[model samples]
Target chain A: MAIDLNGAIAAIGAGVAIAGGAMGTGMAQSGIGSAGIGLIAEKPNQIGIALLFLVLPETLVIFGFVIAILVMLAGGLI
Target chain B: MLRTERMQKVRLLCLKKDRRAVVHELHRLGAIDLRRSGLQLSDGSVGDEVQQISDMLIRVGGAIDVLRAYTDVKRRSQPTPVKHMALGTLLERLGSYSQIGETYQISAALKELDDQAEILGAAARVANALAGIDIDMASLRSDVLSFKAFEMSADQVERLKSTIGERGISAEVLASRMNGKEFGVLVAYDKKASIDDVIKGIAPRELDITMKELHGKPKEAAARIARELAENAKRRKELQARLRNLAAENLDKLLALREMLEIELEKGNASSEFKVTESAMVIEGWVPRKRTEELESRLALATSGRFEMEYIEAGEDELAPTLVNRPSFLKPFDYLMEFLSLPRSDEIDPTWIFIISFPIFYGLMISDVGYGLASLLLSWYITRITDPDGLMYNTAKIWELGAMSAVVFGVITNEYFGFQVTQLIGFQGIDWTKSITSILAITVLFGIVQVGLGIIFGIVNARRERENKLVVSRSASLVTLVSGTLAIAGGFFGLMPAGPSIDMAVLAVAALLVTIIFGGREATEVTNLITHPLSYSRIMGFGMASIIIASLIDKAFTPNWAAGPLLFIGFLIIFIALHFLNMILSIFEGIVQAVRLNFVEFFTKFYKGGGIKFRPFGYRRVYTVDADASDA
Candidate 1:
């Protein structure tokens, strides 16, 4: 259960990476989700198009996840 | 399976006398999408008829709404059976129903009763609130004195009395416990005293008994109001019964009449799209090639062999509407296609490809038997409750298929709610902890294959469209993707020998040059050629996250059998709740991510979906049948 300073820093970095990505995704989706509701209210059949745009920003978080995994691997943690 | 139904542009010429009949037959056949011919007819009769039918529709629609409101009939899950009747018979039924003055009279009487009942109901409520007060209701509204009644807490009533006393307002306060735990206070003061301000300060709700109808003591007033209410109720019941009986007798006929009027209105509207001359009418539209023979036969019957018909090939610049017909099982996938966009008539339909790949992506993302079974049950329940024709039901069917795929993958992986069932059976299964790299490779390879297929499809589409530059660039992009993937595998993963890596790297560079040269401004997408396939690794990432979260929940909340009963039961509940939450997350992420991969990553390569949907001119009749079908 004891971790070296470098290992701790690496874990913290991974956490920060994911946290930053998640917050970015949340901020982007907050605007999209609200606008998408308005769009769907007026034209319900555009729900699929709305969802496509809504999830488009998810790639940012996926990249962060990749980075987190890479950090863990480099840190010999997983 | 990969293309929309073939269509032929059709033009028809029929005698003006037979125009309406031919149009009706065409609508009944439901084969052609009627298009507007450029020629305009100056005839104002069709416009007048459209207005007349519209007015009739409004009256019939109102009657239907009124009748439906009075009845407690549940909507039928199956469509109402069509009653075969000649057009003339339909018109006769409609004419008879329209002339029934009793239904309108009943509606008017019911409205009058409702108005009366509302007034009486309000008086009854106020009378009930004023019960047990002995003062004359008229004196409470006297011009020389002011009376205010309030329902408030006992403490608030005491405070109000003291507040009035402090203000030096000469008022008589009567307080009594009303229903429940609240007190009713009646305050009387001189009209000149400005006591309203003092009462407003206390913030107690004041009861209004200002209606002129109440004159005697509260009890007597209540008695009079009750009598009126009973009479009002009696009249309402009579009107409602009459309306219900009217509905019972004429509801079906009224519905049929409405259908006939709506159809007549549609024919009138469609006539505006026709090109009319002094003695002839011309109509142009697209018809599915397979249905042309049927259309010709039906048109011949309708025009009595006096119509001329011709079919022509669609022009290259023209965009024909798309129509794709699939088997019942594949119908749900059609919903997915429509969700994103429909394929252009000339482009290959990617629905069959998505049908095969989507479930696999979903299964890999939600690879656990317990969650899979839960998803299946959940989707089954949703499918049962939702309308079969709605998007939600189709989505549930797709979910059901994905859940089955999940179960298949779960069996292969030996995962059951993150527990390795293979361990108990002493059998070896793919272990995520030890085989992360291999799993990542497989997902990436799957991504490459799909992306490669997309590029190949792009080339095929471009070649068919005779866009030579597009074909060359797409071909180069495909080569670049393959060589770049091999180079990365060799250089980073040590999957291929170093010599092949050098050759692959050189080939990748050459392909990129060709892509840049031929792709014009779209060459900027060269970066996506590498990043897109790598994006599929999120599948493995999300699946691992689900597994790790489940494992953590198990470790943190799994009950100790040695613990006492209460503590053990508490932990067990938390354990199940956490697992349920995890399953929901897994299912949601599985669907959104799987669909995202196909729609955004794979589809962006080839799909340029702005195709119009084919909507033939016809109403699916529910109450009336076609004349020819009726004869049959």
Candidate 2:
């Protein structure tokens, strides 16, 4: 199928959005997961709470995914 | 809709003889929290008792530690639930252990095992050292005919070489090349030639490694060490077996003793917090007002009318502990709030509010039945594997409830892990392309409502606190938030004629003027008009993100229809892995972001949380029951 210029641009935009979000979430979760493991080592009882805090920052990427999908869908690129 | 439980300050005074009984009764009732009195009452009698209890605690803890080590011989040490026994039952159980004098016996066994471990460890080290020497000896004896070995310094080797050279004794030195500590020389001199100078120059001490001695001594030592190691290992196994047997037989007794000692230690430590006089002990504590009567009755019955309790009205300056009483469904969310901050005594408990909003946001974020089912299963598994009293247990329960909510929401939305499940059954799911405008509008509208509610709550709180300026500013901000939203909506959507837009603008400006004129004390207060509404967009943002990711996963897994089995299997694995990861990310994002919105956006309006949670002095039992609680 012959894709239009706007469609290709929208697809790239979605990709960039998702990638940026993933990068941010990865950076945040790396620090949180490391510290959380150390905390779990000291107080094994804190595993659930530690895990919760460790994953809290992942919302950023999900938000990015949502925006990316919306942009693509709106631009008829999906 | 939200109210913190009332707390009453109480002073419990009893005779020194009734102190233990009174404390035990209070523990059974679980009403009062023993707090140190503000006034300094110089009494040191309880200090000695505390120290004695502490020492006993160490002994009991050490014994349990050893018991735990041996009992888990087959598997890893998992979390064991605490046991609870009635005081009478505990005392009765104590009699049996005391009669047999197992305490001393157990301690002795522990000591013997520790000593055996130490000896076994030393023997292992010696064996290792001997093994190293054996390797060196094998290398040394490989060519004894060509060269003779000497343990000497480098300086001695040099001097010996020179002295031998002067006597016309041609010799080649063969040193232990690894460290140059051991020296060797291959001599090619006449047997009659006098080599007294060489011997004098190198006054080497004997490593005693004559080729024969090297074989015989190492053999003797290795055999002795092997025997000793076998004996120690056998003894260690036997001791371990004995411990395991004892642990199996007397586990109940040991656990009971530990619990009893812990209770005694609590009582002993609590006594120190009490202000004791010559005749009586005065303990000050906070109790829930609703339970004050029950506590009073229990204390009377337990002490036989010998104690006096004076309930004091807590003053404004006093920091009373917060007691939150909520319905069972909302209790788990209360734990969520407590994880962050306990509400102050006078503040509204925001747990109910949290319960109302958190799950909704979480469900909205994930919005997929398959992911929700997975979450429910994962949480259920966590609950099953962990002890019921474990910290993760309640968290798992909370997740289970949230997952159920997500499942319900997902069903209504007709999505299952980004697959339009309803479409397979000839039903239409939500079309983002068609409804994007409405969704965004609704999202922004929800933001306006939440922020408006916050301002209204701020007004109520300010009014309650008798801050007139804050009340006026908050009220004005409420109007400003609403009118400003309307103004933007009307202008952007052409929802009304130009006249309504003018009216909305006028209303917004008028509210701002009121804020500036009447409530100018804090310039910062005006900023919430912009920040608060903007903050609520996160709810929509997070929700959209979840849907987008779910759809992406679905799109990514569109398998080739004509592919072979291996390719199909490969795609299947990738499909499961991708979707599984997306589910986890969505669940975490859903809960955390949802809670964060409420905590940051809603709570900042009315909730000022920083209070001590009511921790009544009692053993919160898990895996053990105090049978006497129902009776007393």
Candidate 3:
């Protein structure tokens, strides 16, 4: 079977988008998780609010995943 | 539903004799939050009384701690039934217990045992030293004994043995033990030779004679030490068992006494904060408006008409503590809202908005019937078993409602644990996959509605505060947001003709300009109005992710008979574990994103919170019971 160069390039682009998004989320959660632990230590009841704040940046990666899925689906790359 | 309870400032004047009873009744009623007068009292009598009460409180507190350690009922055992007593009955019981003098005796016994343990520790150390000696000590106690016990370096012991041999004095090594470079030696030397000369010639600098006198042989002495140790151990056991028995018998009494002493301590501290004179006292505090009458009646009954109380209006400069008053159903959401912030007294509380929208977003994000039912059952079981008023109970109720919402949405989406249940049953539910565009449109519409609600709430809040500019700008911003969204959608999809879209675009731009110039925040307000609705794309994004992951897990676990029984079982285990993990992540992500949209996106518009929570001066009966409630 012959490989489609354009589709492979598009797949690599999708991979880069996901990697950048995952890095962004990880960087954000690092700061948020530490601050969240400090907050929980001071006020044990803030767990829910702390968790909400900690996961706010997680949407960046989820969006990337959705975009990648859409690209793959559109291109029939599977 | 978003309002706070009204509060009133109260000042009370009572005779010095009635101060205790009035304060006691006030605490019992738990209506007022007493503020310290901050004026130093020069009266020595009140200070001395406070010190006395504090000391008694500490003693009783220490006794309770020792009892708790011994019995461990509060620490290790489940809660048991406790008798409820009125204040009078409690005092009567305390009086009877005091007459028996058992609490004091128990405390004294505990202290005595501690001292005895210390002494026993020292004796054990001495016994250890004696056990290292191997000589028959009875022979050393004879009238003509010539042996000397020496603890010295091994080199010194060698030198002494050589010198005694050369001097023609009979000496014999009885026992010797080495510790590093030092030696403990029991030596029998000639009685004629000068023992002082032998010690002075030996390792005099490194010598320590631990055993000076002996009443019996080494073996006999060791046996005696063992017997003493056993007696000490027996005594310690008896004391511990006695304390445990007392705790078991008088646990309720101990709990009540501790509470009573704590109450007295509080009264003493409050008295110190009072503005006191020779015959009268003045106390200031805040009470709920509805409870003022009840407090007045209680005070009258307690002081027998010897008190005068006055109500003062809270001034603009004064910040009254906010106590939110909502219906019972919304009370569970209070924990979540308060975790973010307590709403300011003058502003609207946004907890009701959260209660309405949070579950909808959560349901949409998860969108799986099987997972929803599982979550519902788990939360229900937890809520059933735990204390109803606790934090876990409230949180479980929130999750229970979220799961029920998910179930409803799952039925609409035709998904059950990632499988197309509607298709399996030969029916059609809303196929999210086939109608992705329509789903996207609906999610955008949901965003528009939420943003619209935010602007409306902002307008209403501004109107309440009589801020005309905010009301106008917020309303204009809403118009711009809605029209801009519709115009963009229409132009993108060719839903409308070119002429109308142009007109709609022109109208949107004009409203945006007005919102920017008049809203007083050019960049923030304009960008927020434009991008806020787009932020709701995450709703669709997260819902898609949940479905994708669930389907992936489901696809991985499709049964294949060719893999044989062991492989199939392995796959089954992996399927359960992976699906369980995915379900947890889904729930966590769903709840977080859903609440974040409301909290960060919606709340910023209308809610401004910095208010202090209202905490009344009272103690709840956690371990003890109030006979008044029991009677009612």
Q: Which candidate has the top score in DockQ?
A: 1
| Each model's DockQ score | 0.60, 0.17, 0.45
In candidate 2, residue B87 scores what lDDT? 46
Question: CA lDDT, every prediction?
Answer: 0.82, 0.69, 0.73
- Pairs that collide in candidate 1 are none
TM-score-wise, the better of 2 and 3 is 3
Which stretches in model 2 have alpha-carbon errors above 4 Å? A1-78, B15-17, B39-44, B72-227, B327-330, B384-396, B494-501, B518-522, B622-624
lDDT of 2 by residue, B1-632 (tens): 66788888998878988877788888777889777766566452555656655665576566666666667544433234444555446545554554235534755765776776566455443333333232334344443332343456667768777777677675555443223354433233444455546775677643333323233333355566566657766766776677777777656556656666677667666666788777787888999888989998998998999998898766557779988877675566677677667888876666776776667777766667888899999999998888654446666777887888888777867777777866476767665435656666665576677667767777877788899988887788888888888888789688878788889989998998888777766546677676555545555566566777778867877566579878877887888888888787777667666766677667777788888988898875532456565443
Residue B216 displacement (Å), model 2: 5.7
Over B1-632, each residue of candidate 1 has an lDDT whose tens digit, in order, gives 77899988898988989977897788777888987764466432366767767776787887888888777656423334454445456555666664346777788887887887787777666666667677888888788888888778878888888988898998988776778878767788888887777777778878777777777877688899899878878888987887888787777777777887787777778887788888988888999999999899888877879999998666657789888898898888887787678899889788888889889999998888888999999999999899888888998999999999998887777788878867586766676667777888898898899999989988989999898998899999999999998999999889899999989999999999999999997799888887788789889888888888887887788889799889999999999999999999889888888888888888889888878888898887776666557665
User: True-contact fraction for model 3?
Assistant: 0.45
lDDT at position B397, candidate 1: 95
lDDT of 2 by residue, A2-76 (tens): 779888888898989889988998999999999999999998867656766775565567556667866887678
lDDT of 3 by residue, B35-139 (tens): 654446433135565565566556666666777777755343333334433444544565556522565676677678677656655544433333567666656
Candidate that scores best on lDDT: 1
